[model samples]
Target: MNNVKSLNKWANAHTYLPVDLLRMALGVFLFMKGVYFFSNIQYLVDLLTPIDKIDRIGAGMFLIHYIAPAHLIGGILIFFGLLTRWAIISQLPILICAIIINFMGQMHHQNLLLAILTLAVCIFFLIYGSGKNSADYFFKMQK
Candidate 1:
């Protein structure tokens, strides 16, 4: 089908070396962060407490329960360059919410910085996709 060809073409699109490296680095960082969250779930919940207060009841709870897993999965997919664009798309909302929540009240500079960086990288991936060096390209080649 033409749609399949179009998809393959998109997936095989060339990317600058620097951009690919940046994407890989961001994926690694996010994957590590997800692992850290799993190990320190209570700590993550504690950090979200302030955001819940700023927003509504159970908002922080919802983010931790739902978004955390998505973050972890998205990180894995992005890291492997499997469905990278969709993975980034899924993470965009979480990153935006993180920025907003972390930016409010007595801000932690480090958290804000991390959130901003993640958001920037997510945006980049959303626009540019995985690139020629990715598993996406390999899969497309097989098709």
Candidate 2:
């Protein structure tokens, strides 16, 4: 059908290299940050404790235990442009929470700025998707 062809065309559209580079950089940063948390998990737990009390959903332990691994896997997915949109969506909550916590808590201004920049990058990827250099592009070419 014509609709299917149109969809395929859109999927296979070329993207800017800079966008892909940005995606990879953000992914690497998130992956590294997640890895860092494992070495200093108590810090994450401390950050989430007040949020847990406010949300009352018992998310303190959950966020500490699960968010880092999710960030690691999601970052890899974004880096490779494998299921890129889903990966970005999955990570958005954690990033948003970080932004909120940074603002609400007494963290340094630099941390808040970094969270904002990271969130902006996530928004960009969400809107534009993985660029030409991605695995998605390679796979699309094969189709």
Candidate 3:
């Protein structure tokens, strides 16, 4: 009876969180795409049409060029469970911009869907702010 009770308690304490999964998924997605972006500079440069028209090509390059860092840096932060909340917060705008760009010029349903899903994951990360097992455990601010 005691063992059964303990098993039940352990299960209750270890329920899987959808949000943590979302964060990890986003991290993986970003990391993979970042590698692709860095490998093919021209491809990313073409995507900067919106920013280019506004006389911000340099700025655009700086932002887009750093997508890999988001994946690399953000992934590390999230993976190590350190400063995850801030990392997610930092990534939100980048995901939003990608979504907006995908919607702005050509109405490619696939691109739109991808952007939307990415944005949704960003939102999920914000809400969950990393789970207990994450390195976020150390820097967790008291609310």
Stronger candidate by lDDT (2 vs 3): 2
- 13-55 per-residue lDDT for model 2 (tens digits): 7566776788999889889988988888987777775564644
Best by lDDT: 2
**Where's the lowest-lDDT run of ten residues in candidate 3?**
4-13
Between candidates 2 and 3, the TM-score winner = 2
lDDT per residue (tens digit) for residues 1-143 in model 3:
67634543453355366645656666777777778878887887777565546444357657765666786677667655567667777777777877778766666688678878877776655555566556554444343
| Higher-scoring candidate on lDDT, 1 or 3 | 1
* lDDT ranking of the models: 2, 1, 3
- The regions of model 1 sitting more than 4 angstroms off are 1-13, 53-59
My TM-score estimates for the predictions, one after another, are 0.81, 0.84, 0.73
Model 3 local distance difference test score: 0.66
What is the lDDT, from 0 to 100, of the residue 43 in candidate 1? 73
Candidate 2 regions with alpha-carbon error over 4 angstroms? 1-14, 52-57
Error of 2 at 140 (Å): 2.0
In angstroms, what RMSD does candidate 1 have relative to the true structure? 3.2
